[model samples]
Target: MYIFSGDFAFLEIWYVSSSIPNMLVNILSESKTITFSGCFLQFYFFFSLGTTECFFLSVMAYDRYLAICRPLHYPSIMTAKFCMILFCVCCVSGFLCYPVPIVLISQLPFCGPNIIDQIVCDPGTLLALACVPAPSTELICYTFNSMTIFGLFLSILGSYTLVLRAVLRVPSGTGRTKAFSTCTSHLMVVSLFYGSLMVMFVSPTSRNPAEMQKIVTLVYSAVPLLLNLFIYGLRNKDMKDALKKVLRL
Candidate 1:
């Protein structure tokens, strides 16, 4: 819950796929060919998975805050059933939200050049390939972008604010420090994931900023994926200890 889970998933898939362009741009610069189904899968998966990830992470953050700030009732407040419901809610809700945008995107017709500016599959880029008859394409893009950015931003902001308040309540130097150690990693991941996304898309795409935009693209999409596992997955002492114990067995 510290970071948005849906965007996190989008970022993960985005970065991994995005990195390929950096290494292979020479041979694949303008080769922007994607099957109709491939196009749907890219956007559908990114948006759907990203939404689930965002909501799920928020739930996790709340769970952590409960554990740390309200230890006495943390179990009752956030039980296995509660967590399972959250997971299911995120998955089902994320998937269901796709029908409208998918239908909108599907109605467009593709009949001209199909050069995607950056690598990977961009919903906007794919929509641009739609023939002029598809007047609703731009509306779909704007709608998707607006809904996602707004929903994600508000969700993240509220969750982090609660988390910050919880962190502030830890007394004693060691207690505060230990609380930070747990919170810091998730905070960093959250910042990196959302920060990159906002920076990449908020501004109008311009030819003059083409070079800068490309670099930003790499940062927003690639660096975070590589960093998340290192910072959150491996760096936590408990995770390290668990790995070591498992290895010893």
Candidate 2:
């Protein structure tokens, strides 16, 4: 889906491309020390990428809704110019949303232990390490995180609900199956990606066990990219043929 489609090309590719290499390096190296500035930059890009992903996925859901529910108008409505506008909006929004929160988190004093327990520079871990209690920054960051995650999630859900209704109205069984296959693959990837995020970030628990946090973070970071690679590579006929041609070269 990501490989062949304009909707997914930049955000998904950029995300997995940025994350996996760093993750691999961390795994390969015995030492996992990150300087304070390095940690802040990582946190900045990590959240920015994640926020961008949520926005892009919501854009995809909107695309799917148009394709499924308004087939006749999908082409007209989802024109290249319009898609470029959306792509720009997603990029701008993703980049703009996190810098202030990250700056706030960075300003907080880290007097004592500097070791971050997780692979990535998670905000929660940063909060834990703050020299003074920082309720205000916590509230700001959590509020932004919640709104971005749940707000986009709700939009995706609503779009898909309409899509399901439209799919059901199709007279041909084959048409319904085809629509469902596409939607099911998208939904599976969304659930895998967002479910882990919700558990890791949005859950009510104030204190998550460090080991559990690492495990969940690893899964959330790694699994969706692998799933997307296979789902699109093997299941998408166009993408498969394209890959074959590339391999032949």
Candidate 3:
């Protein structure tokens, strides 16, 4: 907690907290009969948290850029109070951005065949099950998803490019190596996450075969959780030392 305490940390905690428990229960339990209201709530939250994650990832990329590329200004730019406000904006954007797609999808009528292929309340599957073909709704949701994913992906790419250029400009070999080391894990995590999401959503057919989709979804969700623990804890010496101290305390 001490090592990763802040707005981004809190947002990360909430991101995982929103969906992990339900996912765990669904994996262990047999009955998956979620009520109508429950389904919509789950769908809303899953996407909302995902949006929050996207925003937070972009914020983190900016944080790293500032820390490495503009170290002298980073202290003033990323002050605690500024971080809090940024996080609030991220949360609000996350929650507010998805309502258009969710509302458009939810208003559709599901006549029958309520079986949603794959784990969790997938929005695409829900649309597939709707009684009438909702071309307008599909177009809106697809456009929104594409815009969010690609926009953030581009932002992250740009930030990392700046960071890389700065790292290359460091005078000493040791300085360059240290600077690169600080960002490699984060870059890897971001690549793994955005790559999976792009494959999952940015396509003509997002609702692929259930088994294949489930595998991809699990890779994006569970694998990232494990990787984050390893990257943030085991990869970083300061975090490892902090963990040891916390345990001892």
Best by lDDT: 2
TM values, all candidates: 0.73, 0.89, 0.89
In model 2, the clashing pairs are none
Q: Which stretches of model 1 miss by more than 4 angstroms? A: 1-32, 133-136, 202-222, 238-249
Model 1: per-residue Cα lDDT over 77-116, one tens digit each: 7766776677688778777777777777777767767555
Judged by whole-model lDDT over C-alpha atoms, candidate 2 comes out at 0.81
Instruction: Kindly report which residue stretches of model 3 are placed more than 4 angstroms away from their true locations once superposed.
Output: 1-6, 238-249
Error of 2 at 118 (Å): 0.4
Report the Cα lDDT for residue 191, model 2: 92
Instruction: Give the whole-model CA lDDT for all candidates, comma-separated.
Output: 0.63, 0.81, 0.78
- Which lDDT tens digits does candidate 2 get at residues 1-249? 342254564566676655567767878999766778877877877778878888888888888898888889977888777887887898899989988988898889999788777878888999999999999899887887888899999999999999989998999999999998877767877898899889888864257788988888878777777777776557767878988999999
Model 2: lDDT of residue 207: 70
Per-residue alpha-carbon lDDT of model 3 for 74-183, expressed as tens digits?
77888877877777888889999877777788888888988877676767788889999988888877788899999998999999999988888888999998888878
True-vs-predicted CA distance for residue 16, candidate 1, Å: 5.0
When sorted by lDDT, best at the front, the candidate numbers are 2, 3, 1
lDDT of 3 at 130: 95
